[model samples]
Target: MAEFHQSRKNIIRLIFIGVFAVIAMRLFYLQVIETKYRQLANAQAIVRKLIYPTRGIIYDRHGRVVVNNTALYDLMVTPSEVKHLDTAFLCELLGIDTATFRERMEKIIIRNSRYRQSVFAELLPPDVYGRIEENLYQFPGFELVERPVRNYPYHAGAHIFGYIGEVDSATIRRSDGFYQAGDFIGKTGLERSYEDVLRGQRGVTYLVRDSRNRIQGSYAGGMYDTPAVAGKNLYLSLDIELQQLGEQLLQNKIGSIVAIDPNTGGILAMVSSPTYDPNELSGSERNKKFSRLFTNPELPLFNRPIQATYPPGSTFKPVDALIALHEGVITPQYGYDCRGVYLGCGRPIKCTESFPGHASNLYNAIAYSCNSYFSQVFRFIVDRERRPALGLAEWYRYVSDFGLGKKLGIDLPGEYSGYIPDTAHYNKIFGKGHWNSCTIVSLGIGQGEITETPLQLANVMCIIANHGYYYTPHVVDSVEGDPDFYRTHLVLHRITANVSDTDYDIVTRAMAAVVERGTATIAAIPGITICGKTGTAQNFTIINGKRVELKDHSLFAAFAPREHPKIAIAVVVENAGFGASWAAPIASLMIEKYLRDSIATDRLPLLKRISEANLIPEYILEKKRRIDSLNQVRDKLEARRIVAR
Candidate 1:
């Protein structure tokens, strides 16, 4: 009996020890191993506030601050903490009706949980903020939070600088908790491309709250507060004056101009016409203005420099000349007696210059932009190989090396890969063996099935200027914090074409002749040696399911100061007729402006003519008118609905 009682007592003691160990482990897990319960408990007494750092400033090449920040306030609300709120007073302060206030509150609750804070009124005007701040203590859950909004001092570079907006659900998901609702993010252009470098680290502050949900002081004496790191500034290669001039010249027109510094491939100016003020998409009216811009028929939002594509037209002749010379099919002195037209194919292809011996050699041929001469050259190249496919593949390889038919990987977003037809493309269209050089002769003249962006055309000029090498074109010259940004991002890319430097020299001379006395003579600047090419791309539109030819698109590509070219530029004026009339003159003025920093008195008249010209298509104008009328009607209806409510 004594042994039994001792064993039972010992078992009871072991049970007590096991229970104590389990209780101790549970306490440790809850206190140290898990954060959910602790955070939930802290949420009752501590309000965590996010501090948004100032977005990086943007500077032009000359160190002018082009983009800066302005202080704005957002009326934030924590729905759960909103007790005994004066709905009418709040509505009156916000300049909103009770219905609108309730609607906004409902949306906030839906988007963010009732316990969390959300923006009630964003980008509040200074006057409105002053009024709300005076009475903010009357609203229990409402807080005025200061944030930085972008400001464009010059009101230029609407497309280049882009805009930022509140983060969407998709963006929040993609950010992996880095972004939340009400966080602003870049939507396009340099803003979108350099978002990471421009958006600085966010900081957090823990504030102690009393039982009434009022902030008392910094939680834990500010021990856990983190300071926000301001975003790194960006120094851009864009010459603001040059950019402004380009925009001025392209006003009331549908076109694009891209100018690059040949030595560094830094974009000097990029202009897409019909541009709006950058301020239109900032501050309080951003959403309303953005909606209108998005629906505009002119497509002002489109980044035409790298997004729109057009045939290279005669500007492509130099590339063909180089290719022919490399293939040994034509020498620099090779002559084609192009008298009006080429008769090698069943169909006749006419030359722009009908005079005899106009295209007597490669130099004259390029200077004259003779279609017949290049057609024969393309035929010789294709027919030289046993199969036309092999010849086309070779041509494709050469052109692709010049950065056609692919994205140039420019620093901007939404770049379109211009199309270049190859053997496979022809095979799919006309069957493998049925198509030959004659079937696709237009490719030689950069017309049928060959397309390139203005960026690509400018890049081609850079290659010619550099004797077959180019750097990836970029806008940002350097980031403030990172010194190796340019070297690491905008590296030199050499063309793999087998053409020698002599071939480039031959082409360069011919291009100079083009500006000196040939097709683009009007593009000549008095002191600057401008080597340029004129292009008139045939444009077409589908009207009522029928292909309708429209006025040709005027284009010009050029490099200045022939010996050591500083600037390479491309201009495309949509539906503006002959290249020399619109595009060439524009290029000349731009070149002179960039080189001299001002248009000469002699050229001001030409600049005035080009700048005042209105080339927007009639159809586009009619469409815009119709859209404006519809928008007016919609606005009236919205007003009526609000009045009825």
Candidate 2:
């Protein structure tokens, strides 16, 4: 019985031992047979990252950088993975308080995809990047990503340079299948205009993630990644040096300077005062800095060249003359009496000049900036029947043909359509048929609802320079890629009208008179034969419900090389008294500097004086002095009255 039991036990032991041997053999086979698969799985569990592409560069016509990329670090955080992250240390490193950190984290959690780790913050500066990157291992949830932010090489063209900010929910909704959340987009100016051409295709890489959400290895040996095609470069027609100079000229003023090539309508320089530095609104501190700028009283974000409108002043006279001449309402030989004031319009509108009973013809009238002559001519053109004025309806039509009272459809974004009051406009204000040409007669002199942007004033000058045609003003001369693109995109803008050759000659002669012997004598560029017009418009200072007189806005518009025009410019100095004093000289200097490529050193003294001069509130000064005088008189009168009583 014992021997039988031992045999059975041996058999059982053998059966159990055989089963163990079979299991071990199977395990060995599986480990060795699937070695390649196991190796791939293990490798994928370790190291993988996705890389974004670099943005393209923006250059000026001279290949100088206008907008370029600067490297910045993005602070990426994965909330769940940040188990033992040093919150205080991280906040200190990033220059953020705990409340801000918490708020940002909450926003990131809400906005990010649940399937992937989130990008909490972006565009951290180098100093912040250095601090956090050193202790990256200590924060498992956070990582550093390097990318490019837009940088302007030159500080000029602030309004035209525009800015880039992170895409919001509104932008995402209106993205039109182009962008995703958290992308930066151009908010204004040419940056907004050419966003598609400037921002290139984005590439992506497939990164494997484990259950713990740690990156593994590249999927499919990097075959799944698509290389980013870099964005195409933009070559703007801006002369950076000239643009900087223009900005310097308009410093601390509430006006603009627009310089354009009359031939090509290529904007050379567009400067508006109170401009903020482009770099100030870039990257991490963008929101804070931009908020301050946006709420600024002077309106730095306002593009005074195209967006801000003011009376064309004397600058609109040339356009008025052209329209009058084209309509054959007046002859060059036609004369008007300049008694230093206009009296026929039932109002004593005073003239700036000291002309006494001077019988001025077309040339003399323009040269002297005779208000009486223009007022007579305007009344003749609008209200006359036989050789009569064309009336407001026809007049408005002609002006609209010149691209007035409408957006010029410029390439840059945010061009404002200036207001031109017509008969209908009068109806809105004083009821239909309640007002006539006499009510709005000041429009003839570039006041009373006759407003235009600096860009429009420049365009008007270009029209006169070209004898009626102008190319639609644009900043980009050429785009990268095929030569066909440049050929197709570069377009010329010309006006189709019934302007007679004789009329153009007559207007040119009048403008020539302005430079040869007119109010614009200060604009004479030695031998440049520059034709210009000066304007001083009466503006009101309304305070405490009183309309008080203030120093007028001075304006000057000119085209250089009278015979063969190269550049057309428009300058405005706000409340700087006469156009000759402030606006004309600056316009002349810029013309000489640009056309001749060098300006006279002797003129620097004059320009430097202008640079130092301030445009203060004239009414304030006048009121203070007037009150003192009135008080003295009142005291004397009271003493006399008291003695009599």
Tens digit of per-residue lDDT, candidate 1, span 1-645: 999999999999999999999999999999999877776667678887778899999999999999999989999988866888999888877778898988988988887767677888899988889999999989987888899999999888988999999999999999998887888999998889999989898888889988877779999999999998888899999999899999999999999999999999899999998898998888887988899999999999999999999998989988988888888998988888888888988788878898877798887888888889999998888888768999999889999999999999989999999999889898999997998888999888889989999999999999999999999999999999798887798789998876799888999999998988888888888878998899889998886799988899999999998999999999999999878889999988888888889888988888888888889999889989999999999989877865654
**Backbone clashes per model, in order?**
0, 7
lDDT of each: 0.90, 0.75
- lDDT by residue (tens digit), candidate 2, 289-348: 786676555667888889878887767776777778877788878887666788887888
Error of 2 at 407 (Å): 0.8
> In model 1, where is the ten-residue run with the lowest total lDDT?
35-44
Superposed by TM-score, candidate 2 places the C-alpha of residue 490 at a distance from the truth, in angstroms, of 4.1
TM-score of each: 0.91, 0.84
Clashing residue pairs found in predicted model 1: none
Candidate 2: segments with Cα more than 4 A from true spot: 1-50, 207-217, 356-359, 386-390, 430-434, 482-490, 541-549, 616-645
Candidate closest to the true structure, highest lDDT: 1
What is the alpha-carbon lDDT for the whole of candidate 1?
A: 0.90
Minimal lDDT window, size 10, model 2: 42-51
Question: Candidate 1, after superposition: displacement of residue 436 in Å?
Answer: 1.4
